[model samples]
Target: MYIDLHNHYLPAVDDGVLKIEETLLGLKLAIKEKVSTICFTPHIWSGRYNNSPEKLKEVFEKVKEEAKDIKIKLFLGSEVYYSSTIAEDFSKGLYLPLGEKKKFLLVEFASAVMPQGVSDGLYKLMLEGCEPIIAHPERYSYVQKDYECLFDFAKAQIPMQVTTQAIMGMLGRRAHRTAVKLLDEGLVSFIASDAHSPEERPLLFREAVRFLNRRYGYQTAKRLAIDNPKRILEGKSLLPVAGRKGKYSPFQ
Candidate 1:
């Protein structure tokens, strides 16, 4: 049983499941993959997909009602696009956190260029008592160029979440390489299925967990897939991961 901290299964909210049928299909796939808990993190960009907290709650309720009979649990959050004003907007209650506790916020940066005030922006959020979890940092070209910046974020106790498909090589070579490097270096805190649709970005929790176990041992796999995410939901601090020497070597 894994808790998926990042997913886009809510119907018609963002770039996720477009209709109710698609939402149900995505939930079914998640359940099949042993994902007991899922966080519906639709995109919340400033001028693009501008989803407010109240609006998201209404949409979440509708989707929740539609999938009420499904055994899997549902949650509401936003994969917020990072901007200098994010902290200010969050202060005004413009966004939703990963869970009810509101301890962690899932954030993403632009793919081409890293924002100038990115670090300061995240710091401001932290000052407001919200831990920012950088989503798919490996996918960002800036991060790919200077991964040590990721280490800096991790050192500051800000967590980084990598998508499962990236590790599985479904997102191509650069993403796959970065994901592996981050995992091997122990910079990643959570491994989540950023599933959008049933067919396109289906939940691969079972496969991801199995691969992590086989390549990195049960401890590392379990921590990324289950333990750490559970802690995040519970509003607790995560344990640090020790970096391994060789690539994908089993934990000693």
Candidate 2:
């Protein structure tokens, strides 16, 4: 079963789907794609949109109840903005937890700039026992400029998720190329729709999986689509080292 650990599925939550109808429509597409499990990651940060834990749980419960007969397992999480207070706030002794009991935090970076002190802050979060999963590295301009920065993140043992839309060239050429490059080099740890809504952004896991299978074979697709995603959902520690230059032996 494929698990999408990063997504903006909650309605009127952040930049995702606006209404309940659109949210359900997006989910229906996900079901058709055969994506067995999906983590509903609404934005939870201090800035503009701050969805509290209670609110998040309530919304997820509502959505899950609505999608009960769809054969897709729904889970709740937050696309957390990795802030300075993340470590303190994420821990059991402190603030609210998001995403798999807060073991995994969907961290998003500034769009244009790949801020300084991120790696150090990541190390601190790790020390606090929180797994930092960077969302959509392929869409980052800095990543487009220098792939090695991503390589550095990968080497730091941070699992990076690739948005399905990026692979589909929905984000544009640079993002598409970066997405492909990451896939070829085994830098991508998971593939998610990042679907805001059915109208705005749609689910294309099946087509993306087909393309990936066609290019890299079935097992490779399974690694990115299934195994690695499972590992992330389970909060498994990432492997040391980085994406290979040649080929990755599937799910080793």
Candidate 3:
């Protein structure tokens, strides 16, 4: 079963689904893509979205109840926007983990600039026994300016996720090129459908998986689409890719 670690299908939470019908449509598309488990990751940006964990849980329960007959398991998480006080917020339970294991937290960086003290915050989270999964590193402007920053992140043992749409080149040429580079460099830990709605950013897991399998190989595709994500959910160490040591592997 494929596990989607980053998605926004919950109704009226953030910039994801605005209504119950849209949420159900997104779920149907995910099901068609052979997704068995999905994590509904709403944006948790302070001073903007401000999605509290308690409120997220309440919305998740409602979505779960509505999606009861879909045969897909739903999990609650947050695509936490990175801030200077992230480590403190995480300790205060301001963000949700990837799954019930509570080992990995899905995080996003600012689009305009890399936030101050992000590296230190990530290191602190690691020291506190929490793995930080950087969501869609390919979309960030600084990393686009310097791809070597991704290597630095890898050296710091920070794992990354690339959106399926980015890989498929739907977002734009630059994002597509960056995603390909990250995958080729063995820096990406997961490939997820950051699906927000059916009309705009729908789930493209099946196409993305096929592309990975054809371009890279079956094992590489499986590692990003399945194995690594499962490991994250199970709170186990991810397998090494491209012969890298300790850190999660990408394509070999």
| C-alpha TM-score for every candidate | 0.95, 0.89, 0.94
Off by over 4 Å in 3: 243-252
- Candidate 3 contains a number of clashing pairs equal to 1
Clashes of 2: 0
RMSD of 1: 2.7
Model-by-model lDDT, in order?
Answer: 0.85, 0.75, 0.85
- Superior candidate under TM-score, 1 versus 3: 1
Error of 2 at 21 (Å): 2.0
Each candidate's clash count: 0, 0, 1
- The alpha-carbon lDDT assigned to residue 218 of candidate 1 equals 76
Q: Residue pairs in steric clash, candidate 3?
A: 241-249
Candidate with more favorable, higher TM-score: 1 or 2: 1
Off by over 4 Å in 2: 92-102, 238-246, 249-252
- Put down candidate 2 lDDT per residue, 67-119, tens digits, no spaces: 77777777787787767667667763333333355576778888798877888
- Cα error, residue 123 of model 3, in Å, equals 0.9
Q: Which candidate comes out best when scored by TM-score?
A: 1
Ten contiguous residues minimizing lDDT sum, candidate 2 = 237-246
In model 3, where is the ten-residue run with the lowest total lDDT? 243-252
Tell me the lDDT of candidate 3.
0.85
- lDDT string for model 1 (64-171, tens) is 998999998888888999989989988999889987787999999989898888889999999999999999988998777878767557667788899999989998
Candidate 3 per-residue lDDT, tens place, 1-252, comes to 788999888889898889998988888878888998998899999999989999999988988889899888888888999887888888889999988798999999987688887889888877768899999988988888888876656887777899999989998888898888887777887799899888799889999989887777778888889999989888888875541223234332
